[model samples]
Target: MMKRLLLVAGAALMSGLVIAQEPVAPPQVDLEQQQALRDAVSGTSRGITNVMRDAYRNPERTLAFFGVTPQQTVIEIWPGGGWYTEILAPLLREDGKLIAAHFDPESEVAFFRRSRTEFEEKMAGAPDVYDKVELTTLNYDPQLPIAEPGSADRVLTFRNVHNWLSAGEDKAALVFEKFYAALKPGGMLGVVEHQARAGTSLEQMIDSGYVTQTKVRELAEAAGFQLVSVSPVNQNVQDSTDHPEGVWTLPPTLRLGDKDRARYLAIGESDRMTLLFVKPE
Candidate 1:
């Protein structure tokens, strides 16, 4: 009887201690440091004001909407020129792992080569920040070898799927399947791409730099992922779906140069789809 009473008292004491523990804080990113990060990636030393205005405004919310925490084993696909890489690497530095994987440029289209040297240099410049980052190459073909199955916790791709569609093998879908196969059960795949209007065909997506949300959902569902959520945080409602040069004619790519600079600037970046999907257990 005495031993039973002692066990009950000990259990209550442990429960009280657990309840008394304070909740831990979310990761802290200082305003100044965030500004510095923007400046570092925006190709300008004085970029914080302009970069921060956009980054902190809408994009961060897109990331938050997807429930990206600092604890996942995240693989970011096609970290071209490391734009998002600059932000994500540091954010995941402390307790999380960030893997920056790019197309094997030796096998990719010619354009990726232009950024190859720059991407390597940018990441090399911050060895400490990327100490936990792993750089892997995606073969763009199904037969190519990659990590073991069920290895990652999340796979994220931003603004690059259209290029895969253009590659003609439906490498995009194959890659999506690979992502599904690479994650543990219940792992996530997060995507942000230029969004096309409903019913835009796949060929048109390759040509226009826009992909319909339906196409993406279909591909993911086919790969055994369950649609979790979609967010409009990155959506741009002003796009009229009638650009002469398509989505590339907008600010970041401005393919036409000075012809529609003012117009594209006013439109800002193209409307994007932010989608989240999870592998079922």
Candidate 2:
């Protein structure tokens, strides 16, 4: 009995020693960096209307959840109207690189052409804030690549999944695969999209501009990404996923105009799912 007790004690000590030797994960974003990020989000250059959406978007918290730092190369997919671009460009200008992957300038579609022109004009208007931004083009074509393989530390897309689904399931899958190829091993893809009700059908997901969390996960997993985390930072519990004009019936878009505009305004923005996925190392 004495010998057995000594062996048990020795095993316990060795187990503890091994645990103590295990390396700890360093802090991804320190306190000082967090403060700086917040400051950038709240900066006056973002303009009053853009800043107003901060409460709903929770840009600082969302970026922090995605583990975004100023030093990492970030590719923002389809920065329509430069809403997030206003914050991202200034923050990453000094230490990091910001790549804006926008619609192809040669798009024959009138809306795409107009949007591309407007975005170029916006950047030109604010050269001080946007001059360093590297412009690239991304379209539905799988042959056209967005960024170099394994070159980006992070790939971010906001409210774009539904459009891809509208294009086609295969197209959506191809885009996610492209995102997978753009990131370094262990790098992350951050997605913020309008959230559909749980178990929503693919038809509704495409039509309503709101996608189910499960569907998004399935797509990412199929693209060889592991869903690491989901955040409620941009969630709006008030949205019931039954809007007549779809998610756009809500604020910012207000496609309904003054018809029950007050009601939609009360609900605020559409409920959003903020997800993080990682490429396996």
Candidate 3:
């Protein structure tokens, strides 16, 4: 009996050694594919005006940080003026899908009507670039749906949260719920918004076109998402976040219109927060 027990023990030790000796797989890094995506971002087909914002926007790094790959379905909420649309549509045209969740077309607001017209014209003029692009409508109404539930691999929003907040906190929460519903389990939600100073009141956030990081996370968490990570890829340290016209006082908008235009230009764009959240599997 002792000899049999000894043999079994020896065999168990040998099996453990074999298991330890097995090779571990290395983490995957598709360098060639990544380079190709970066090339598309910098391509001249995007035009000069869009290229000018590349430095401030940091499209390549920002999208990479958000885990935006070339082969996944992505939904972009409120793509005002189609700033990111220009890059996203072309990059995803070959292998992936790009869905633009735009404002409700039936709205009587003149700005919404004109922006929709311009966006359609832009898309129409560039069939080669936007042929596969899909369109969906989003509104502040809680009953309205943004995209099909669990359909998108990723949902992205850029500087549009403040506009939702303008409708009120409940509406903003509903919008987040829609985003959460649109993404597949374990999918991502990437947000880039004007960052308010920490501890700013909700009233200030609503008034100044900025939001605290804490508030954003709380909203996401409340909507059944897990905060995955935050990236400083879009941070602008020079922005003081205290202008009379809120974020519009900065460049691009320059709401003051030559009243300290050079100073604001030196400050550059509004300081922004880039957050990545994931739906739990």
Q: Of the candidates shown, which would achieve the greatest TM-score relative to the real structure? A: 2
- Ten contiguous residues with the weakest lDDT in model 2: 18-27
Which regions in candidate 1 have their CA more than 4 angstroms from the true location?
1-57
At residue 25, what lDDT does model 2 achieve?
Answer: 29
Question: Would you list the clashing residue pairs of candidate 2?
Answer: none
- lDDT tens readout by residue for model 2, 1-281: 99998898889888884233222222268997798788789877787898899878999998898888899899999898888898889889999989999988998888887998899999999899999999998887878888989999999999999988998999899999999988998889999999998888999898899999998998898998877778889999999989999999999999999999999999999999999988877
lDDT (Cα, tens digit) per residue for candidate 1, span 1-281: 99998898899898884343232222234565455334434434223544553632254665555555566677888887776776677667776778777768685467676676577877777687666777877767677534568888788888877877887636777888888987888778888989999988878898898989998888888888888778778888887655888888987778899996898888888888888888876
The residue-by-residue lDDT of candidate 3 on 1-281, one tens digit each, is 99998898889898884233222222122676578569778876687887898889998888887878788899999897888998899888898999999988887788987888788888888898888889888887766677778999899999988888888888889999999999998788999999999999999998999999998998888998877778899999999999999999998999999899999999999999999888877
* Ordered list by TM-score, greatest first: 2, 3, 1
Q: lDDT (CA) for every model shown?
A: 0.73, 0.89, 0.86
Question: After aligning candidate 2 to the native by TM-score, how far in Å is the CA of 140 from where it should be?
Answer: 2.2
Clashing pairs for model 1 are none
lDDT of 3 at 199: 96
Error of 3 at 281 (Å): 0.2
Per-prediction TM-score: 0.79, 0.89, 0.88
Model 1 residue 86 lDDT? 66
Q: RMSD to native for every prediction?
A: 10.6, 7.7, 9.0
